[model samples]
Target chain A: AQSVTQPDIHITVSEGASLELRCNYSYGATPYLFWYVQSPGQGLQLLLKYFSGDTLVQGIKGFEAEFKRSQSSFNLRKPSVHWSDAAEYFCAVGAESGAGSYQLTFGKGTKLSVIP
Target chain B: EPEVTQTPSHQVTQMGQEVILRCVPISNHLYFYWYRQILGQKVEFLVSFYNNEISEKSEIFDDQFSVERPDGSNFTLKIRSTKLEDSAMYFCASSEGINSPLHFGNGTRLTVT
Candidate 1:
């Protein structure tokens, strides 16, 4: 079984400040990691994903995350955050169920607050 | 860009009543899925469907819950007896092929009282 842990439950940052949301996972093999964001009343939107290749993956809305195998962590980071970036973020680990299909196990989520 | 769509953005039903959530996946996608999130909790996967059959399902998907692709494009999840605990936001998603990123719908808020 695979699981994800997001250490921060809530974080607040001022506009123009750098931000990082921590995520840790426990998986038996190589993991497929993803970051998703959900604004109020909105569905989960894919921020970025790491399947294979470069350790750092860039995503929509100027968001990026790095996959660190040694740390068992895939943390999302932004050089600067805007007021509109306030949202709930989730970290998930995907496990292939075979035949090319997979299911994602998500963390409880970290709610981000951006102050202007 | 194409998107998966779900209907009845909000639904209010009495406990013990039946409810069916509908979704229309992207035109060319081959895999479909249903996920739900209770208030202030992690999003949980319910089931995944492909080729008109259920490819996988989580333990939360039990006898009371069922999914069907009645026609070509519509995927529906039916709850035999709604419970208060079943009240949550349900999201539908679809993907093009093996390991493709999933595109999600806006989600339907199911409120059982």
Candidate 2:
């Protein structure tokens, strides 16, 4: 079975400050990783995804993540965060269930709060 | 850019009543899925549909739950008897291919009283 763990339950950062959210996964093979963000009363939006190739992947809103196979981690990072970037972020792993169907197993999520 | 859309932004129903959540996936997408997130839990996958049939489902999707793509544009999930535990935000998603990134809808908040 595949699972994702986000170590941080909540993180608070001031505007213009760097931010990093930790994510670790347990999978038998090379895994497909993704980052998603959800604002209050909104749907989950895909931030970025990693299937293969580059260890570091860039996403929308100036976010990026590095896939570290040695550590089983895909940590999201931003050089600077804007106030609007505050939201609940989730990390997930996509796995093939069978018959070519793919499903995502998500982490508990880390709630981000921006300080003025 | 194309995106998935889900209907009935919010639905409140009695515990024993039935409920149907509808979704219109991206026009050219071939695979569709249903996922749910409880108030403070991780998002969980319920089922996946392709070729007008269910390709996979999780344990949470049991006998009381069902899915259908009655038409080319709409996918629906039906719960015969809603339980209190079934209340959650239901999300619909679609992808162009097996390995393509999934585009998700805003989600329908279902509340069972």
Best by DockQ: 2
What DockQ do the predictions score, one after another? 0.70, 0.79
10 residues in a row with least lDDT, candidate 2 chain B: B94-103
lDDT of 2 by residue, A21-60 (tens): 9999999999999999999999999999999999999999
Clashing residue pairs, candidate 1? Answer: none
DockQ of 2: 0.79
RMSD of 1: 0.9
Error of 1 at B94 (Å): 1.1
Over 4 Å off, model 2: none
State every prediction's TM-score relative to the real structure.
0.98, 0.98
**Model 2 lDDT on a 0 to 1 scale:** 0.95
Clashing pairs in 2: none
Q: What is candidate 2's CA lDDT for residue A10? A: 99
Off by over 4 Å in 1: none
